[model samples]
Target chain A: MTAITVDRLHKTYLVPEREGGLRAAVGALVRRRRREVHAVTDVGFTIEPGEVVGFLGPNGAGKTTTLKMLSGLLHPTSGTATVLGHVPWERDRRYLGQMALIMGQRNQLQWDIPVLDSYKLNQAVFRIPDADFKARVEELSELLALEELLRKPVRNLSLGERMKCEIAGSLLHAPQVLFLDEPTIGLDVAMQRRIRSFVAEYNRRTGACVMLTSHYMADVEALCRRVIVIHHGRLLFDGALEELVHRFAGDKTINVELADEHPLDPAALGPLVDGHAVERSATGFSVRVPKAETPRVAARLLAGLPVSDLVIEEPPIESVIEQVFEATSAEVDGG
Target chain B: MTGERLDADWTSGPRQAPGEGGLAGLVRHDLRILRTYLSLGVLNLVQYRSDFVLSVVNAVITLATQVLGLSVVFGQTTDLAGWGPYDLLVLIGVHFLIGGVLGLVVRPSMEAMMEGIRLGTFDFTLVKPADSQLLASVQVVRPQALVDVLVGLGVVVFGMTRVQASLSVVDVVLSLLTLLCGLVVVYSFILALSTMAFWFVRLDNVLAIFQSLFGEAGRWPVTIFPGWLRIVLTFAVPVAFAVTVPSEALTGRLTYTSALSAAGLALLFFAASRWFWFFALRRYTGASA
Candidate 1:
């Protein structure tokens, strides 16, 4: 069954226009000008039940806007979306009770209260029974390793700890759908990994659908197999993660470590296939080669040099997504 | 990599959410949420004792200045605009009472609502199943204002005792009804003004303007102002409804027409403010465009 289906969703914002200087400001006071900004234009996608999907975009690409629309926090300028068989913008209590939205940049906890108290407030808001609330809190605390952290005030916890508590608080009701917008932003790598694993496990346990948006590719790599890429408020790509890499990033990286500390000569590697550049480091050199030529280049490097450690990897997801953004923008510019 | 799957199943509750119930049930749920908010506010106050002390000191200084102003005005004249010393005392007490309620709940909540709209955190409020206005109104609880309210009650009692006339039950009940009407009017006015933040984005001075005007005009009867200013105080901003009308009810000087008008205006303001709030919310959510 489909968990979410957003059809031709569009959200356009009319931002007031103003220029600097007192004269212009006074003029604006008399009669303000406005310009329309198409924050999300014709964006559409379907997310199946229990499927974890990553939303990838740079800032202002409308990822958050789309998430807000899906979570019923926003009303789209046009089109419609349904989550778990209910129109989201109607904000049906049953729908809201079955879903949760966690924004990493913003916190839902009271800053001065203990994290557990905040969880209790969510319990009341979501109307979880006392026993169920306690059981769920215990379950989430165990999963997120949040035993001692719940008693401390939210302000007293570190960013990572606070985020973990936030995740726990949002899930106290055991929502069936989760819209996590940059849920791992500003967290350290370990904390990010911990959250990703928790989300994956939560999905496994409950069979809930998850749609996550993040700047951290590691989050996507660890948690999601499918990704939707958006740029300039338009959908650019929607497919499997491997397909994204294969389509936009055609090259694979080869890292070679010499058998001994010796001077490396670029000329010796000479005219690497397809004129790909070799980047030399203190201990090793990495060269990018087309996916088809990866085996040939590996064979040549082993046959020619004293190669001790060799590793071949797809270009990092960060660089690959960046290339996709640039490629899409270049296409827009060309058209 | 997919994490190891856990076989734990969701222990689902076969029940609808609290807000999905009937009207009476929804009211009960909202009241429960309000109790939680108030208790959380008390917890927050425990952490900021200095703020509590400051608020106490502020309330003291405010009452002292108002009392001293009464003394000064009484020294100059036995009565101003047909209002005697004791009558004006009741007015000042009513002013503080209304101010205390606003400070305790309405003002802080409105400020938080403005900040939330500015910072985009208000979305959390919208996504909740409960009524958005109910959530926003009780979102922040300022316990410090309890001092002002208690002091205002003390002032009202002291003023009424100092006067020669004993208050009949009808008088007290009438005063309370007017007070409720006044509070509804004031709250609706503040709400309508704050809702403008969704469009203006810079209303920092808006509430300050209300406070200043109310402070200046609410101490006296709107009748004292010549013509235009009295109309503005009574109709435009409703400062007269908040303070003077309740005082009139207590002083037994309220006309039946004025009392009826207060009730009618309270209803009008409440309905209008609620309508404007939803309109602004629709605009903010881009529902119109």
Candidate 2:
């Protein structure tokens, strides 16, 4: 069975609004004004049991609202969603037992107690048997290198260390469906890689479904094969990560390394490098050309310049994703 | 980092689905959860050992002020209203005892919950696979408040000796039961007040106003208040039910109908507060959201 199925999910919030200053505030007292915030629109997707999917969106783009709904922490304004054969918003005890939602800034562990002690509380709440609890703790600590941090209170741990401990504590229950919202936020690059690898390993071993959202594209690149992107509370695209890059990235960058120095004017390179900005160094310059014109551009550069090593590459994924957002907003403004 | 297949570990006994566990089993489950929370609460208190010692000093000052005030009132007259000085002492002891119980767990947990709501840390609480009300009502405990409990007990014992009141086993049992009933109502009332944080996110002063009301009016018996004020104490905030009814039971002044009403109100308030809690939860626009 599919681990998650969401159809036409929507969430709207009515927030009070008033103009700044005393006159408007006094007027609002008599006639309150409220604006409807459509946090999540008619979004629909289904994830397989063992799939690792990336949820991509800019800030306030409804990524968090959708995750909160699927994790059963929210009631949708209108829609249907079932995770592991149960309606999420019903919040059945058994449903909650099989799933976990870990938000990076929000910690479930008790701050004043040691990390292991907080896990013990989870052991009680989740009704984990002794043997399994012990084994899971041992495995998780070894995986997270948390043996040293387990005995110290959470407040004493650094941001990265506390995040490690927090993730370990959330996993002690061995939830089948894991929702990680920006789990690698505010960590150094090395720590981010460690968390990303751990999450991949955990998902592989248990055959659990993992849905993750992050502002760091490295996290999405390292862990997720498929990505679903949303903007303005609406779905923009859902496909393989490579397909996303191929669909939005119409231009390929061609880099050339010259064996000998060549004094060449960028204007003399002709129309192939005309519109694009060519980044120039002492040896060679790199220019972006349309995917169809890469071969023509590469041949012309080779015949025209001193003999050099040439390479053609796709644009970086960050620029590709940024282009996707920019194109959508341009459509919105023009429409 | 290990490539070892964890397939065997996934289907193990750690994830026990909700089964046909009987009511007794459910009670045991809840009791275990409560014990875990209590232990964690104690561990937290242990970290702040100086706070515990300071609570003792605060307790001593509070008791001294109460005694000095009682002395001034008793010095001028043998009784206020229809109650003697010793009877009033019993009422004062009951007030301290009830307040101590609330300060121990109820007040601390409510404050923590409110702060969590304000900061959006309450999302963790909503995601737990347990009764949200029970979890929210007891997440933080302060054993430092036990000083008030001990002082209250000491005053009750001393007052009984001075009055030389003859008490039977049934009288003691009945008073204890009434005291339990009174506490239930008080807990529910405070919970309802705290639940307002869902709609009014910045209600830090609400509790302060409530404390002042209970502190000033609860010192004298509800009977001494004006008619409107007495009704308010008995029903609105219910400080009278929490302190006066238990004191009445101990002093042989309780009527059977009054005793019955206390039990009824306790159940009604508990149900209403529970309903209100879930209703407010649905309205909770999370700070993060």
Worst 10 residues of 2 chain A by lDDT: A266-275
Task: Report the poorest 10 consecutive residues by lDDT, candidate 1 chain B.
Answer: B1-10
Please report the candidate that would top TM-score against the real structure: 2
lDDT of candidate 2 at residue A293, scale 0 to 100 = 83
State which candidate has the highest lDDT: 2
lDDT of each residue in B73-176, candidate 2, tens digit only? 99999878777888888888888888888888888889989999998888888877778898898887888887788888888777777765677898888889
Residue A79, candidate 1: alpha-carbon lDDT: 89
lDDT of all predictions: 0.84, 0.85
Q: Compared with the true structure, what per-residue lDDT tens digits does model 2 show for residues A250-298?
A: 8999998877657676677656465677887678878888888889888
